[model samples]
Target: MNKILLYFLLFVGIQSFSQELNCNLVINAQQTGNENFQVFTTLEKQLTEFVNNTTWTNKVFKPQERINCSMVITITNKSGDLYNGSIQVQSTRPVFGSTYSTPVYNVNDKNFSFRYQEFQNMVFNPNQFQSNLISVIAFHVYMILGVDADTFALKGGEAYFQQARTIVNYSQQEGFSGWKLEDGLQTRFALIETIQSQTYKEYRQVLYDYHREGMDQMYEDVKTAKKNVADAIIELEPMNNRRPNSYLMRTFFDAKADEIEQVFSDGPSVEITKLTSVLNKIAPIHAGKWRSIKF
Candidate 1:
């Protein structure tokens, strides 16, 4: 009887301490050599615990309310303590009054390289540079939060975005490849900066409108919901015209590509035509998908 009572209390204690992110993490090392492979297993376990158990923000979140996201790390090569890999980070948030959780972030980082040792703990210090593994993980965690928060409230993710920016700032001196401006368009620094830029403020507003005013209203009022989504998609035009396939622009299309196609599959011809035009100009890579939208 005492053991049962103790177990119940422990379960309740764990539930009470839930954090903002409910991240599902997976690390694959099959590509790397089989030598000393046990370290990768330890690394995977540590990363899962780090992302799930750590408290990131001051806001308390109930177990069900925690944000849902996933991170998959695939190691391509290893030399001594250095490991080269790719990180695929994806996240989705639940629409109000519905069971659907729309995608908010989808990014594939090919330049993710880090160093790890067997049973070594991953540490992240916001004010200083740490291991590339922890630094990159922390950066994406905050980015996921920022994107999710912005979907619900206009400019609601400023704090989270700022946290990401700080990670970038602190990480720049770490000599990591992805933490630099010259690392190309798909780099981490470029995307976070684009999110926080004043010039793209309206784009953030569009995110809130698209998710809250748009997706949440689909079953109840798709016509009005479609209009709201169209407004948000069109909002991408100006930013795209200015930056011409920017990191943020590209990330948006990456995450919403399927959602856009599904939502507009049965949309009106006029709406489809408008969306097709905008998509062609902003993200021509998905032109085939956009063109398939039925009138």
Candidate 2:
């Protein structure tokens, strides 16, 4: 090919090479009493490759455009090669006009049970019923995308959410613990469905407002942005009364407790008091912080 054509192709190749995720994957097996230390170390390296090497979506990404996220997998037990553990997955997105990135998804799944062998190839097939490990990891990967996308646009992550739903659907065939609604409120099923549910339409908008309209504006103007954020927090008040610690409410506060506290601490007293009252009712676990919101 001509030099110009070759360079153009190289540019496209490089751009397309950037995966959608800039994930920091950590696998901890300190609690896996029976597994060999080398086995755990190899598994951690294998998992890092499985996560970082795979391209989770069709979107072409610039290296800098890749979403920033972290997955820390803690292996708590091992019976032969079968493992039981917890995986904490969290992702953050940049505020439109600032260098600051804010958390979009922060969840620690306790029911993350799976099987693994040292150096066994880790593969993920979204449409097929797969091992619990691959399915759970892929579920969170898509969710990180879905959550971040929703912040950029109103329900913009529909396709990503559907992909996550697909994983959950196929996971049902595997009969995994966290894939079903009966598994618990904190299961993977509840998180995806709640975001996709028409019954809680305002939930996604609240996400969008908090990130796009609120955080995006913070760099340019803090006063107006804080009001927008407070307004966004109030949007959840009605849902809080209806659902009263529903799946979404809990996850929302889980990812946002610290950020919310800081955002309202600087606003006008009246607005801060009103927003804190609403926040205090919804996320009472952070009652101390919410209650302490002051001018």
Best by lDDT: 1
lDDT of 2 by residue, 1-295 (tens): 1221112111112121113787888878767665467877787778778887788887766778788889999888888788888999998876654445678889988989888777777888878966888999999988888888888888888898999999999888775698898998888998888888876778999989987788777656667777898899899988877778887888888899887776666543335667877877888889988765666
TM-score quality measure for candidate 2: 0.90
lDDT by residue for model 1 over 147-218, one digit each (tens)?
Answer: 888887777788889989998898888778988889987889878877888766667988888987887666
lDDT of each: 0.79, 0.78
Model 1, residue 36: C-alpha shift (Å): 9.0
Candidate 2: worst-modelled 10 consecutive residues by lDDT: 3-12
Candidate 2 Cα errors over 4 Å, as ranges: 1-19, 34-36, 267-270
TM-score of 1: 0.89
Error of 1 at 166 (Å): 0.8
Provide the lDDT at 207 for model 1. Answer: 83
Which residue pairs overlap in candidate 2's backbone? none
